[model samples]
Target: MGRILLFNKPFGVICQFSQDGLHPTLADYIPVPEFYPAGRLDTDSEGLLVLTDDGQLQHRITDPKHKLPKTYWVQVEGVPDSAALDALRAGVLLKDGMTQPAGAALIDTPPGLWPRTPPVRARKAIPTSWLELTIREGKNRQVRRMTAAVGFPTLRLIRYRIGAWTLDGLDQGTWKMNT
Candidate 1:
């Protein structure tokens, strides 16, 4: 059987196993050998990152053609109304091309959410709101771009789930092997 691992990758931590010549990587947390990340979350973003030893599993999760949904909790700079939500659900045209239609809705703050380090800048006049967005494709910075396109710039992004797996009890920089 292949080993499967779920890690809550914190902000500023690279998803790669080694950071010998770069910033902090998975090596700083998980000690498991021969396992690799199923997908990548940028260092500026935080959330669930799955690792596995099976090559096919990695391909299945990372390939956009598979249409596996990745859910994110995003805090945007302004409150989005029904029309904005509709636009996000329909699909947002980006410089890379038009993104696939996504599943999006306003969401309450998740329980036990950790404060991000070097926290996001606050705006006195502008209020922020959270939204749950599930996208089938993982284009570079797609969530941030989509929210921005709808007049609500993203202040922070946390991916909470991928397919059937989720961060669940995993804390920042912590890993659990369940396979």
Candidate 2:
């Protein structure tokens, strides 16, 4: 086993340790050195990010062949119907290709959820809903693309779990060494 760190990444923060001169980078939140993110979370997304000092462990967490499940708490622009949920479960086709079938279900907004800075855009007329979506593949913007393809574009995306790790006790912009 190697040193493992679980970080609660904030939105608008880049995943890299180096400064980007624009958005805040991981360096701003985590001071630890020599640890690199095992996988990536987009600049617009938030939540659990795993970092490690071990190359083999990073590869295992990131390689698609390992198929570690990633779960997200997604807030979409509109309520998804059964058909939409089924589409997500069956796999949605994207410009890149068909995504692997995913686990999708309607979920109430997670308890103890931290509010996103510059909160998600709200239209009083169009209602929003949350879904717990889990995917085994890590395609670029796959979750957002899948929801958009299903006609309920994602308004907010927060990764809640990755494999056996989760954001349970971690707070936004904080990190902890995995015991």
Candidate 3:
């Protein structure tokens, strides 16, 4: 058992603690010292991020061998039809490799979702839709790539859950020490 901190990371916040001199870093939001992010969420992405003080625990959370499931709420440029959804469920091939089977489904906009500061790009002609996507692997830009492969590019991506931990009750830019 070690110190675990669950943070609702805001979009545009860099995952690292040190200042990048261009964007806000974890240090801006998290004042706690000696804790590091268990895994990375891209600066363009938002939502749940787990941090820990124990090195072994961090390894467990980040190691792909653990197959820890991560879920995201994705807003895409186009409405995903059954075919697109099926493709996501089966596994979509990316430049890196074929992704593992994922859990994908259409979902309404998440309740109580905080609006992104710089808002996602929008088009008056194309209507957007939401999807709940869960994946076991932590490939680089996998979710956005997955949606793009299926012809529905992701406009906004927010990580909702990682393993047993979730973003529930965690507000953007805030963190809490898990008991």
lDDT (C-alpha, whole model) for all candidates: 0.90, 0.96, 0.95
> Candidate 3, residues 1-179: lDDT per residue as tens digits?
77999999999999999888999999999999999999999999999999999999999999999999999999999899999999999999999899998999999999999999898888999999999999999889999999999999999999999999999989899999987
lDDT of 2 by residue, 26-90 (tens): 99999998999999999999999999999999999999999999999999998999999999999
Task: Give stretches of model 3 more than 4 Å off.
Answer: none
Give me the displacement of residue 178 in model 2, in angstroms. Answer: 0.7
Clashes of each: 0, 0, 0
The prediction achieving the highest lDDT against the true structure is 2
- Report clash pairs, candidate 2: none
lDDT of 1 by residue, 102-166 (tens): 99999887789999997989989998899999999988899999999999999899999998988
- Alpha-carbon runs more than 4 Å astray in model 1: 20-22
Error of 2 at 66 (Å): 0.6
For each candidate in turn, the TM-score is 0.96, 0.99, 0.99
Better by lDDT, candidate 2 or 1: 2
